[model samples]
Target: MPLKSIRVLDLTRLLPGPYCTMLLADFGAEVIKVEDPMMGDYARAYEPKTDEKSAFFHSLNRNKKSICLNLKSHEEKQYFLRLVEEADIVVESFRPGVMEKLGLDYQILRDINPGLIYCSITGFGQTGPYKDKPGHDINYISYAGLLNLMGERDGKPVVPAAQIADIGGGALPAAIGILLALIERGKSGRGQFVDISMLDGVLSWLQILLPGYLTNHIEPERGKQTLSGGLACYEVYQTKDDRWLSVGALEPKFWSNFCKTIGKEEFIPKLGEPIDQQDVMKYEIQKVIRRKTLKDWLEAFADKDACVSPVHTLHEVIASPQVSARQMLQNIPQQTNSLQQPGIPIKLSETPGKIRSQAPEHGEHTKQILSQFGVKEK
Candidate 1:
C-alpha cells in the first residue's frame, strides 16, 4: 500500500506502457486507464482469448480502472485534463509527436499540473534522429546492437521468443524511472518528465560489454560472451528424453563437481575451453547427457554441488514446486472460469501487493471516474 494514494492516468496500450503501470498498480496505485474510445486497448482484441477476453489483456491489466475517451474531442480532452490535475503520474507510449498533435503533450500536462510525473515510453525517445520513426521491439533491439549477440556461432541472429526489448528495455526501465522521479519529486516539490527509449534501454543494459568494446574495440559475436554459451561449462544440453538441461557450472568448483558427478573426472579442466574450437568437450558432455533422462540427472545431482537445472516448458514452469511455494501464480475467478495470472514479484513485508480485481471492461468506470473529478458525461 505504499502507492495507495498515487494516481496514474494510463494513456498506453499493448505491452510496454501497460506493464510499467501494471507494476505501479500492483503496488496499490490508483491506475485509471484512459483508453481510446474506438478500440480501447488493442490488447483486448489480440489473439489467445479466454472466455472472450484476450489473455494478453487479462494478464497485464488487472487492479486497474478503464475509461474509453476520445482525446481528439475537445470535450473529452478537457475531462482528461481535469483528471490529470489530481493525478500524480501519466504514462503514454505514443509516437514522438502524437500527443502534441492532440494538444496534450507533456509540456501541456506539466503546465496544468506541475507535480505530474509524465512518462513517455517510445522506441527512440522524444529527441533523436529516429524519434519520429515508427518501430517495434525487433527494430529497437537490432538498432541497439543487442540482436547481434543472441544466436549460435556463425549462425544468423535469432529473434528471442520473449519481447526482451518491450518488457526489459521499455516496461521495466519505465517503472524504475517513474519510481526514481517520484522520489525526486518529494524533494523538489515539482514533478518531471521521464523519457524512456527502448533502444537506449537496450544499450544501457549492455554496459557490461562496453568497457571491453570501448577499450579494445572488441565486438562479441553470438555464443562468444562468457555467459552466452561461450564455454562448455555454461551451456544447454539435450537429454535422452529430448528434454534440455541448463548447466551453469561456471566456477571451477562447480565445473569439477559436475564432471565428477557425470563420472568424467577427466573432463574437469575442459570447462575453460572455447566451445567453437574445443567443442569436443561439449560434444562429449552432450553425449553423456544424452545417455540419461532428465529425471535421472535431476536425481543424481539432487544433493550435488553442480549448478544444473531442467529447461522447463511453459506448463512445467507453472506447475513447478518452487513457483508454487513462492506464490508466483494466482488463479483469479473470471465470469465463467478461473484464469491463472502472474502474481506480483516485489515482496514487501509491510505493504505487499495483491491482485485486488481482474482487468476492467472497456469504459467500465468512465462515468464514475469522470464524475469523481466533477466532469459530467457530456
Candidate 2:
C-alpha cells in the first residue's frame, strides 16, 4: 500500500509502457488506463485468448482500471486535462511528437498540474536523430549494438525469446525513472519529464562488455565475449537423452573439479585459454556430457563444486522449487475462478505488491472513473 495515495494516468497501449505502469499498479497505485474510445488498447484484441480476454494482455495489465476517451476531441481532451489536475503521474509510450500533435505533451499537462510526473517511453527518445523513426524491440536492440553481441560466433544473431529491449530496456528504466522522479518531486514540489528510450536502456546493459571494447578500441563480436559462448568453461552441452545442462565453472577450482569429475582432467590446465588454442576442450566436454543422461549428470554434480544446472523447460520452470519458494507464481482471484499469474518480483516485507484485480475490459470503468475524477460526460 505504499503508493495507495498516488494516481497514475496510463496512456501506454503495448508492452513497454504498460509493463511500467503495471509495476506501479501492482504496488497499489491508482492506475487509470486512458484509452481511445473507438478501439481502446490494441492489446484487448491480442491473440492467445484466455476465455474472453487475451492471456498476453492479462499478463501485462492486471490491477488497473480503464477509461475511454478521444484525446483529439476538445471535450474529451478537456476531461483528460481535468483528471490530470488530480493525477500524480502520467505514463505514455507514443513516438516523439504524437503527444505534442494531440496537444497533451508534458508542457501542456505541466501547466495544468506542476507536480505531475510525466513519463514517455520510446524507441530512440525525443532528442535523437532517430527520434521520429518507427521501431520495435528488435530494432531498438539492434540499434543499441546488443543484437550484434548475441548468438553463436560467425552465426546469424539469434533473436531472444523474450523482449529484452521492450521489457528490460524500456519498462524497467521507465519504472525506475518514475520512482526517482517521484522522490525528487517530494522535495522540489515540482515534476519533470522522464524520457525513457529503449535504445539507451539496452546500451546501458553493456556496462561490463563495453569496458573491454572501449579501452581496447576493439568491437566485440557475437559469442566472443568472455562470459558469452567464447570459453569452454562457461557454456551449454547436450546430454545422452538430448536434454541440455549449463556449465558455469568460471573459476580455476571449479573448472578443475568439473574436468576431473567428468574424466576430462586434461582440460583443467587449458581452462580460460585463448579460443583457437583450446577450443577442442569445448568438444571434449560436450562429448563427456553427451555420454551420460541429463539426470545422471544432475546426480553426479548435485554435490560438486562445479556450477552446473539443468536447462529447464517452461513446465519445469513453473514447477521449479526455487520459483515456488520465492513465490514467483500465484493464483489471482478473478471473477469466478482463480487465474495463476506471475507474482511480484520485488519483495517488500510489509508493503508487498499485490494483484488487487484482473485487467479491466476495455473502458470497463469509463463511467465510474470519469465520475470519480469529477469529469461528467457531455
Candidate 3:
C-alpha cells in the first residue's frame, strides 16, 4: 500500500479531522487516534448506538488504533512529543490556539521532528477574523454563503441533509493538503503546516458560481441559477408514486433525446428559454412525469440517451445495483459480527484503500502503542 510506511498521529475527536485521518488509514497508513483519557472522542456518546457503541463513531474511526492521554500532564506531553518524533503526519481540529495552549503547536513539534506534516482543520483557519469562533458543519456553510444558495425559488433556504462543509470542505481538503505536503517533503526533506478551513474549503467549491457573480456584479440567489434549478431541463420532477426523479438533460442533445423520449417534442426549443417560459415548461414536464410511476419512468429512460435518474432514498441507494457493482459498501469486521459500512471511494489500480479493521474502543491500545513506541509507562 502507498501509505503503509507512513504514520499519522490523529488528535481530532469529531468529524473533520477524524474523517481526514480515516482516508489515510484506509490507504494503509498507521493512524493512531489520540484522545482524552476521560471522554475519548465525543462521537462515542453520539446517539443511535449499537450495544452502547456509537455507530457514528464507528463509521468515521474505522481502520485506526486508539490511545488515551492527558495532553496537559507533563509526563504525557513528553510521551506525545516522543510519538511526534516518529510521526510522519499530525492532524488536529482544535481551535486556533488550543494546541499552542497545550504546548503541542507545530512550532514546538517541528523542533522535535523536522519532517512533520502538521495539519490544522478549523472553521475559519489559523489566522482570520473568526479564527477563535466555534462552529459546526452547518455554521461553516452558512458563513460561506453556500447555505443561502441551496433551496427553492422564493422559498426559505433549506438546511442541507448532507454535511458538505464538514466532509467536503474540511476533511477532503485536509487529506489533499497532507498528501501534497508529504510529496513536497520527499523533495525538500522538510515538512510544512497545512491549514484547512471549512469556510475556505466551501468557498473553493463555488468556482463556477463565484466567477459569474464577481464578473457580473450580480448576487446569485437561491434557485435562480442554471444549476440551482432555474432551468426546466435540469430539475427534479415528482412521479405518480410520489417518488422523485432527477432530469439533467442540460445539453442540447440530451434535451432533444429527453423531449422525444417523453413525447414532448414541442418542449425542445424551450429547454433554456426565459425564466418565465422555463417555469411553464417545467410545470408541463412535471405534469407529464407525474402521469407515470417512478419505476415506469426508470424503465422508459433505461435505453434512452437522456440524463434521467431516480432520486433514491438512503435504503434504496444502499441496495442499488450500481452501488453494489462499485463495491461502495463493505462488511467491516467488528468485535461481535461483521457490519456493513461505507467502502473506500478512491479506486486505485495499485495500492488501493482497504478497511483493515473496525473502529477501536477507547484507549484500546494505549499500553501496547506506548510499548511499541518505546515509551515506558511510569
Candidate 4:
C-alpha cells in the first residue's frame, strides 16, 4: 500500500531483477515485466514445473503484469519509451552497454522522464574492468572471496544451496537502492542511476573475515575460524538418526549450560581453546551428540537457552512452526491446481504487502496495457 502509486518497468529475466521488482510489486506497486516476444523470461523453461508453470518463475514473478516487446524494433522501442514516461522506476539486469546498444539506457529514459529511477543490476557493475564479464551467482561469490571461506579446512569450496549472490547481493540491494532513490527524489525532485554489482554485494557480507585479514595480515583458513567450524561450541553435529543439529552455544554461560545438561561439565572450560584442542573437544562433543536422536536433543534443550536447533530439510522447513507463525507461505489457487508461493516477509503494521495475483503468462496483458497507454501494438 505504501508504493501503490509507484510504477516499475522491469526488463530483467532470471533471478535478480525480477526478485527486486517482485518485492516492490508485493508492496502494491504497479510492475510491468518487459520480455522478448519469443522467449519471455528464461526461467519459464526451468524445471520443477507444476501444471506447465515454472515453480521458480511463479515464486519471483507474482503480483506483476507482463508484456512482450522486442526492444530491437523501432516501433516497439518507441512504445516502451511511452510507457516509461509514466513509470517511476526501470530495472534491468543485462550485461553492461546492452541497454545502451538498444537505445533504452538510463540517459535515454531520463530524457523522457527525468524523475525515473533507473537501476542496473549486473554481475560486476556499470563501470568496472569486469563489467562486461559473464557470470552467475557462483561466479560472483568466487570472485568476491566468499567461496574460499565456505567449505572444510582443507577441502574445496562447496556450492551453497542458497543463492547468496543473486538474491542477497543483487536483488535485496537493488530494492534498497531503489527505495532510497525514491526518497531522495521526493526531496530533490530528480532521479539518478543505481548500479548494483553482485560481486560487490557478496563481498560486502565479509565484514569480519575481510577486516581480520586486512588488520592482522593473516589469511583466514576455511572451517578454522571461531564461528566457521573450529570451535566445539559452534558447529553442526550429527545425531543418532544421521540428522544434523546446529549447536551455537558460543558464550561461556551457554556453553557451560549445554555441557552440564549433557552430563559433561568438564568440557565447559575448553570452550574457546586453541584450534587443535577445540578439534578434540569437537570430536568429543560429536560423540556425545551422536548418542541421542534429534528429537531427544530437542526435548532436552526445550527450555534451555543453549541456542541449539535442528538443521531441517526443505520439506520440514516449509512446515516449520516459526515459518507458519510468521505467515511466510501462501497458497494461490490456479485454474487446475493450487500453487504454494512464498509470502512477503516485510511486515508493516499499517501497510502490509499481499500476493495480489499469480505470475502473468507471456504477453498476457500486452494488448490491454497498450490500449490503456493509447498505443496500439502493431
* Alpha-carbon TM-score of each model against the true structure: 0.98, 0.97, 0.98, 0.99
State the local distance difference test value for candidate 4.
Answer: 0.93
Model 2 TM-score on a 0 to 1 scale: 0.97
Ordering by lDDT = 4, 3, 1, 2
Output the TM-score of candidate 3: 0.98
* Residue 174 of model 2, lDDT score: 98
Runs with alpha carbons beyond 4 Å of true place in candidate 3: none
Per-candidate RMSD, Å: 1.2, 1.2, 1.0, 0.9
Task: Please give, for residues 1-378, the per-residue lDDT of candidate 1 as tens digits.
Answer: 999999999999999999999999999999999988888999999888998999989999999999989999999899999998999999999998899999999899999999999999999999968999999999999998888888888899999999988999999999999999999999998999999999988888787676779889978778878877688888999999999999999899999999998888998867676556547888888999999999999999999988999999999999999899989999989999999989888899999998889999999999998889887795
Angstrom error at residue 3, model 2: 1.0
Name the 10 consecutive residues with the lowest summed lDDT in model 4. Answer: 225-234
The TM-score that candidate 4 achieves is 0.99
**Pick by lDDT: 2 or 4, better one:** 4
Lowest summed-lDDT stretch of 10 residues in model 1? 269-278
lDDT of 3: 0.92
Q: How far is candidate 1 from the true structure (C-alpha RMSD, Å)?
A: 1.2
Give the alpha-carbon lDDT of every model. 0.91, 0.90, 0.92, 0.93
lDDT tens readout by residue for model 2, 1-378:
999999999999879988999899999999999999888888888887776778778878999999899999999998899899999999998989999999999999999999999999999999968999999999998988888888999899999899999999999999999999999999999999999999999989989887778899988878877888999989999999999999999999999889988998888888868987546888888988899999999999988999999999989999999999999898877666777878889999999999888999888998898888777877
Error (Å) of candidate 2 at residue 364 is: 1.1
Backbone clashes in model 4: 0
Better of 1 and 4 by lDDT: 4
Model 4: colliding residue pairs: none
